[model samples]
Target: MSVAGEGAGVDTGTYRHAMGRLAKGVAVLTTTAGAQDHALTANSLTSVSLEPVLLLVCVETDARFHDAARESGVFGVSILAADQRALAAWFATPGRPLPGQMDRAPHHRAESGVALLDGCLATLECDVRDIHPAGDHSIFVGAVRAARLAADPKAALVHFRGQYSALT
Candidate 1:
């Protein structure tokens, strides 16, 4: 049965309303596994810790790349700049070819050889530390092995209420 229904008279809308109140920064989660590259635009990313350099990204349980992400053991988190709206759309749309997919986006591979997107505000190369199943999603916790920030400051692209917006 239904896990949420197990509780007596729980208001499901409360969960949705609470989540809607939380603002999140958008990012592109990328990985190369089994001779193919996969990227998805995601807003479900956040820093979990600093002492051990941990971050987390949540992927839908039925996403096409979910298995790849699980098996690859590594992934890249690219914080999209405000100017990269097109890039964000490209990755977010399934069955659409990524622009410049043929040519690497001025990136160097991590030790795991996962291609990280370039020209981002920041990039984190990480090794998968744990995967926790959360509702209809899988939360992948990663240990940051390498990271770099752009020399110049730039606004970040954010997704909210089903649209892409830029920081002022």
Candidate 2:
């Protein structure tokens, strides 16, 4: 008896549309290589193991952030607040310039040496614990070096149904 989720029968477009219903918090993944900084907007971040304090971010193979994350061996996650919609969209843009891109926003360095955007609802600094390639994207597992709550926490920014919304 084949189930509804069984292979080939599920079309990619349909699968994507179905998953779009999942409301997820939006985060900006950041890394630095030498003097250069790279970042990508990701909603694929999820807590993996509580004992080890691990989290993972899925990055496309061709994305610039992928290479930076691997090489730096460290990264930062800034959980955007509702007021940070513009910041989220800026980092999400494709083919944006690498240099001076970071200057476009206000941020500070985490202990892990990665940039953490200011005005976020929360922040996490992490050291790369492991990496696994899954299909078109690579999952980078991070061991939390430090986690912090905003000085004044605000509503979370969420992505659902191919749009960004405030989770108030």
Alpha-carbon local distance difference test for all models: 0.81, 0.91
Model 1 / residue 35 / CA error / Å? 0.7
Q: How do all models score by TM-score?
A: 0.84, 0.93
Identify the candidate with maximal lDDT: 2
**Poorest lDDT segment (10 consecutive residues) of candidate 1:** 98-107
Stretches of candidate 2 off by over 4 Å are 1-7
Q: List the residue pairs that clash in candidate 1.
A: none
Candidate 2 shows a clash count of 0
Give the CA lDDT, 0 to 100, for residue 66 in model 1: 77
Query: Could you give candidate 2's per-residue lDDT for residues 1-168 as a string of tens digits?
Result: 335555667788988989899999999999999779999999999999989899999999999999888999999999999889888899999999989888888999887678999999999999999999877899999999899998879899999999999987
Model 1: residues with Cα > 4 Å off, grouped in runs: 1-21, 97-108
Deviation from native of the Cα of residue 10 in model 2, angstroms? 2.3
Q: Give the per-residue lDDT of model 1 (tens digit) for 1-168.
A: 247556467677876666766666778888877788877889888889999999988999888667788889889888988888887887787776644562634566767787777778998999999999877899999999998889995888887666778985
Instruction: Give candidates' CA RMSD values in order.
Output: 3.1, 3.2
